[model samples]
Target: MDTKQLNYYAEQDKILIATDCIIFGFDNQSIKLLVFKRRIAPFAGKWSLIGSFVKKDESVKNAAKRVLTDITGLENVFMKQLKVYGSVDRDPGDRCITVGQYALIRIEDQDIELVEKHGAVWYDLDKMPDLVLDHNQLVEDALVQLRLKASYQPIGFELLPEKFTIPSLQKLYESIYQKQFDNRNFRKKIIALDILTKLEEKDKTSSKKGAYLYKFNRKKYDKLADAGINFKL
Candidate 1:
């Protein structure tokens, strides 16, 4: 139904309010974005964000969560709605207002095989192919928000593995900031956060002496971050 025909009681329930997701993943090497091919509908073969219509008795967040479960098969993941795209021609099907959100999930639990069944694929932000509709703009907006988020909060947890090395952290930060950092200063600043505890054992596979790994201490960081302790590196 178009937006014009939604006022009556019976027609109101049929109104479409959809949600599109910009799911982000980290590969320890570089950041990646998740996109899916349009299996059915207006743009049959074009790449697009994972999306679904708002369901009965479901809130906007619930609709997004259902999309996550239905498409990715991952639950209790990190997600937040970025904005709503309601351009008259945004969705060719009808007058649906699409809520665009960006989600961060651990790569290990990404269910790549299951999602691939729908032709869902991961693309590097720098080298992505042309997307359908305004989906590309949605992704750009989401990335800008993620970059800002990484500043005060260690949003990298959504991307990084459980146990990571200082080099891994540095590289992640560099990818988000798009700049090279002096290793010594980088370590100094990140260590100063006091949220990462050095492990006794090192990752020997990478080298002979190996690099010491660190784990994020969420309990401690939350307490400090609450007190407005700035986190930067």
Candidate 2:
């Protein structure tokens, strides 16, 4: 490292970079978001998205992953960058820029102890409370992105259990899109996709005539994708 280069870098302005995660989980009925109270002075004890400052040694994606793991104790969950928010006055406490990443995880897969330890609570999408800073905007953007992605990609499987019934899957899609789909059409469309394997085991908890469980076949979906077949739902 040359002294001239070191001097040039030292003269540059320093700004804080952060990553905020909008975690969406499905619990068989509706989609929910994970939020916790902000511990900082500017908005202490207010509802806020799970977030962390990007460390000097870590990328923004890793920072988001770290925050997610700290709260949910899960790894390799489906996550994607939604947007970067850099409004000059978005944060009153400091000149900070946040990269928003949204993640989908099965609600049953997370470690409850870790979630509680971090003071996090899952809130229904429709009844979410006011959040700190621009988190509300982030949530709105994430929901839009989620619906868009789910329509063309088989990403909704990330929010479901290993095996789920067709009715349960329909409910999941309805919850995401906030619309009711014709049962026959949904079932037909999903079956035509040929990405689900019907199992003999029945989930009898919902009814006496139980619905048969189905598991998503990721390999089949991947192969179809590689063959240029589109998944539409």
- lDDT agreement with native, every candidate: 0.85, 0.94
lDDT of 1 by residue, 1-55 (tens): 5989765677454547888999988777778888888877889888888888887
lDDT of 2 by residue, 164-205 (tens): 999999999999999999999999999998999999999999
Off by over 4 Å in 1: 1-15
Checking candidate 1 for backbone clashes, the offending pairs are none
lDDT of model 1 at position 144: 89
- After TM-score superposition, the amount by which residue 164's alpha carbon in candidate 2 deviates from its true location, in angstroms, is 0.4
